[model samples]
Target chain A: MILKSLIFINGFALFIGFLILFLDKVISRYGTVTITLNSEKEFKAEGGKSLLRVLFENKYFIPSACGGKGTCGYCKLVVSEGGGEALPTESLVLTPKEIRQGYRMSCQLKVRSDMAIYIPPEYLEIKEYTGEIVSTELVTSDIREIKIKLVEPESISFKPGQYVQIRFDVDGDFDYRAYSVASHPDTQGEIEINVKLIPEGLGSTYLHALRPGDTVYFSGPYGDFFLNTDSKRKIVCCAGGVGLAPLKAIARYWLTHASNREIEFYFGSRTTKDLYDHSMFEEMAGKSPNFKYFPALSDEDPEWDGERGFIHTIIDRHLEGGYKAEAYLCGPPIMIDAVTDVLLSKGVPQERILYDKF
Target chain B: MNLALILFASIITSNIALTYFLGMCPFVSISKNIRVASGMGIAVTIVMTVTASANWLILNKVLIPMGLQYLQFLVFIITIATLVQIIEIFLDRFSPALYHAFGIFLPLITVNCAILGVSLFAMLRVYTFWQTVAFAFGSGIGWFLAIIAIGGLRKKLMFADPPENFGAAGITAILAGIMALAFIGFTGIASL
Candidate 1:
């Protein structure tokens, strides 16, 4: 009787499983559809996958934070044709104005039919790269510097201050977190990034645990906070904590590529131990007449000798007569706001003051 | 057993939501907006009807005949989950409009205690096949009514400006409690 009951239960379960499978096969089979991008590129994609996944497979990387969950609202793209009405989930993330303008979260949009989408010009250049960690060093107590050597398609071309998104698999769903490149853009075969542990931050925890031989997948060359090489005005760069990564790239690229341009870099930390790699900037300053390095500490310390107090308070002392400078600020929101105010008051035009706040 | 009375009692007096309080998770969450709440309600009603009826058949015919009545809980839940999946696929294929309206909510219904509760209750009450269907449908409608009412109340309560300590969830719980009390008024009018 027990054997008979076991067989009966198994038979019932198998029958239901097969039934569900049959229904899924018949119902979800939407066939193949053509995905046209930017009115220029077109590819055939399976109808079941989301537009974001389809695009990702095609090597076109769109910046998204919450993977394809539609929670981040960062994967917005212009779907010009064959895109249906926005679903309820998409409506929560998208503004009414954006919806009216035909912007939809590609992650939430299932590719059920032939469709046309417009990708931004710069995003077209974004590429996914797989690399092995060449080195990992604890730059400070909280911050670690990771250097990665690209394996496939070994060279990457990106502006100095742009960032990349590292992909992580949480359960089965994909989650991406962005970090700015600290290495010089000219270092095409490799990249470096600094990660500061933010207790309980998923990306930081994962990245911090990575060893030298581990492999990672990341996409990009995103963000517009890069060095404006065309600008003839003097460059004023300021960074706080780990925000120095992108600014380091920008300053080093500027110092190496265009040494004729006057540039000053100001790095702020809480204490002496919080500050890192001032010697590298000092070395660069010694070589280049136009480059000046100022490392400041906000908190009191007996061992400190350089500028004290906030970086915003010391900005005026450096630019007594020189106000024709474009400011590049990257830090916490409060620091960025305070520094931007100082730069604006110092006669830097609002448009010329670029910032990326963490 | 009078099927009409079962239906009436379930919908008005012994509502699965207000009285039994089975599917409180979706009740509080989906009740924030009437449109989504109605969609969820309709989806829950459809799922409950089919799963409850299927479970009743399985319990009376297969389980009792095989003397495997002890496996009722497991078998009933499996039936509900599989039936929900099949219903979702069928709705997607045949009823495109209805599928678009509540299709996304089908996944949410798979683990809903309310659906499981209907099947278990039918088993406990020794309900016949048709009676189980009526009870499930009525319970679904009862849940639907409660959520919609709470949603409308919450919408108006947004402007009332309750204390800061009573956040959205806190305010919603209070609203559900009050609504449950109001539903109690119909207790003696009709009962199973």
Candidate 2:
């Protein structure tokens, strides 16, 4: 009797599934969608798919951190025609200028009919690069410094603080997760990112399980979280844990020009062992008079000589005449919020403080 | 019962929110603005009416014959979810304006109690097919009327100075109570 009952239940489920599929075939089937790209190229995509999914399938990947979940506003395209009105979710991300210019979130854009779209030229250049892991070092207990040398393209160049989206194949579907480029910009054939393992994070788990010399597919440097070269304000950088990656690149990138401007770097860790590298910053500061390094430890540690307590609190005692200082902060939200609160308290305008929180 | 009386009874006399109190979720949450409230109301009414008749068919033709009457809740929900999905895809492909107008609310209808409630009520009351259709349509319109009315009142309430205790939800709840009392008068007009 139990066996019969189980069989009946399975049969019912299968019948419902098949029934739904048959109905979908009759009702929701659209043959094809023609998409015009940049007014120069055109391609036909399978109809009844989101524009983001179709574009990625065709190898024209617009950067989407949320994997077409419509949370991140990265995958935006200007639809010249055949694209419907802005989705409610798109309003959270698109500026008034972008909205007027007919920008729509590609993830939310369902390709029902032929569409003419304008994609940024930079995004058009975004391509997947195959590389071999040159080295993977335990920079800290939780952090790994992954250096990948491109085998195909041989090189990648990016602004000091921009990030790259590494495509990870998890559960048979590729998810693109963004990471800031940690290595110096001068490194032509290689790029490094400091990845701290996030608890149960698919991307971090995949990155952490990699062996040296394994082939890696990390795509181009994306994101506008770069240093403003035009700004003459004193650059004050605050970092926590693996957040030091982008700030290191920005600080070193600024060192080449020297700008004759003061650049103070504040790196905070739980203890001395959690810190990635202090000697590199110290060596750079020794040579550059305008450069300064302040490494702070939040927890107690023996035989350590540096500023103690939270990095924000440490910077609180030192920030003076900060009217000309533009703070660049990168870290976890706790540190970002603490540093931002401290910075704001010291009369730093909200616009002058820029940060990337993980 | 006649169709016009059912319609009128649903819209005024026996409002789903104000009378049966079936769809209070959308009534309270989406009843802030008149435009959104009307959109939500229309969407709910359409969903409720469609789901009710469809559930009636399933309950009679599928469950009753098979002696699987105990599976009413599960099957009913599956039918409602499937129907909502079909409506969404249809709207997306053919009616972009309506799809955009519905936005998140169309997808949200799957979880709404009002759609499921109409199906349950139809099953419980043991109405015939035609009667079931009328009740479903009436119930939907009644829900629409209640939400839109509340929506308009709430918008005006925004400009009015209510007591300190009447913040968004408190004021809306108090108003709902008064409206429910008014709807009690409609009970004398129609006996659905």
Candidate 3:
């Protein structure tokens, strides 16, 4: 009798599953959508899906930090016609000026019928990547250097100082965070990034748990923070902690193709223990006499050596006679602010300063 | 005592938004504009009326006869979700203009607590079919009235010099509190 009851329950479960699947297929059949992206490109996508998902599926990549949740307000596109009314979620993020110009959150707008959309020119070049983690090493207690082997696309051709968005799966949450690419532009089949763990950060937590050989989803070669080729001024690169990621890329670029211009790298840390990979910088300095590595320690112990004091103060003391150097600053907000003020006061042009802050 | 009294009490004396606070998500979100609020209000009213009547029939005919009364909440939520999906498709096919107006809000309505709240209350009170219909319609209208009133007040308040701390949700909550107090005035109305 118990076996018979178990059989009955299993049969009932199967029936319900089939019923739900049949109804889903039936409901999906009623809606048809044709999406014309950027007017020049056209594709037929599943109706009732968000425009962002459809566009992403069609390889028209638009940057979305919230993964189509509509909370990030990053995936904005101009819908010329045939899209339905702007949703409440879209309205919450869109400014009055943006609404007037036909900008809508692509994730919130569903393609009910044939619609025309306009994507930005810059976003047209964005591409997705699948990679495997080649190495994960703790640079500091809170900072990690992750090296990934690019499986598809073989190699990514990016500027020296561009960043990539890394995605990880954790507890059913598909979260992505942007990290500066530390690997040199010439390096093929492999990429590296330095990630600083923010307390309770979803991406950092997942990344901390990740081991070598773990497959990861990442996209792009985004951002334009490279050295300006047009300018021949001296370059001063300043970084704190894991802000060394992008600056490392810039340093690698400079090392490969030696320029007549002078470059000085100022790396700051709380103590000697917080520092990592000092030999790499020292080797670069050895190769090029024009290149200088200044590792500044904020606090010193009894056996202390080299430069000591705040990085900005050290920079102020060393920088002589109103030099025309383009300053690259990356660090915590407080550090970046202090460095920029000092650099600006020392006669570095405002337009020549390139920086990124979290 | 009767259907009329129940309708009156549901619509005025015990409004879902002002009293029970069931559908506050869409109430606050879509209530930014009067036109959109009215459109959502009408759509919700239709869904409530139809779903309430259908659920009453299902409860009396299917669940009650099978001794499955304990499964009412789960059954009601699933029924409401499926019914909303079906109605959304039908609206898109037949009435394109109405669908265009309420299509985005339809998905939001599926998870709205007010619809389930009304169904549960009707079941709890042992309301008959006609009384269920009346209560559902009255409650929908009550929600509509409350949201539209708040929407108008918010529109006017946009230009007012609200306090720094009481700018968005703070002032809105104060207004809602005052409205709740005003709604209490209808408690003493003559019985239908």
DockQ for the candidates, in order? 0.46, 0.42, 0.21
DockQ of 2: 0.42
Cα lDDT tens digits for candidate 3, A210-254: 899998888887776777756777889999988898899888888
With a 3 Å backbone cut-off (N, CA, C), the pairs that clash in candidate 1 are none
Off by over 4 Å in 2: A1-11, A21-29, A61-72, A227-234, A254-262, A319-327, A333-354, B1-8
What tens digits encode model 2's per-residue C-alpha lDDT throughout A166-257?
87887787877888898778886888888898899878888888888898887777776788888788899999989899998898788786
- Give the docking tier of candidate 2: acceptable
Worst 10 contiguous positions by lDDT, candidate 1 chain A: A314-323
Q: Give the clashing residue pairs of candidate 3, or none.
A: none
Question: Could you list the chain B TM-scores for each candidate?
Answer: 0.96, 0.95, 0.95
Error of 2 at A265 (Å): 1.3
On residues B1-192, what C-alpha lDDT tens digit does candidate 1 reach at each position?
899999999998999999888999999888888999999998999888888988888889889988899888888878988988888777765655577788568888989999999999998898889999999999999999988998999999978999989988889898888888888888879877
Q: Over the stretch B2-75, how does candidate 2's per-residue lDDT look in tens digits?
A: 77776677677877788777777778889988898888878888888888898899889977887777778877
Give the per-residue lDDT of model 1 (tens digit) for A313-348.
Answer: 888677643468888888998999999888888888
Better of 1 and 2 by DockQ: 1
Q: Which structure is stronger by DockQ: 1 or 3?
A: 1
lDDT of 3 by residue, B60-123 (tens): 9877885666667767877787678778767755565687678578878889999998888888
Question: Can you tell me the CAPRI class of model 3?
Answer: incorrect
Where in model 1 is the C-alpha error above 4 Å?
A1-29, A63-74, A87-94, A126-156, A164-179, A186-220, A257-262, A269-274, A287-290, A297-325, A331-350, B13-32, B66-113, B150-190
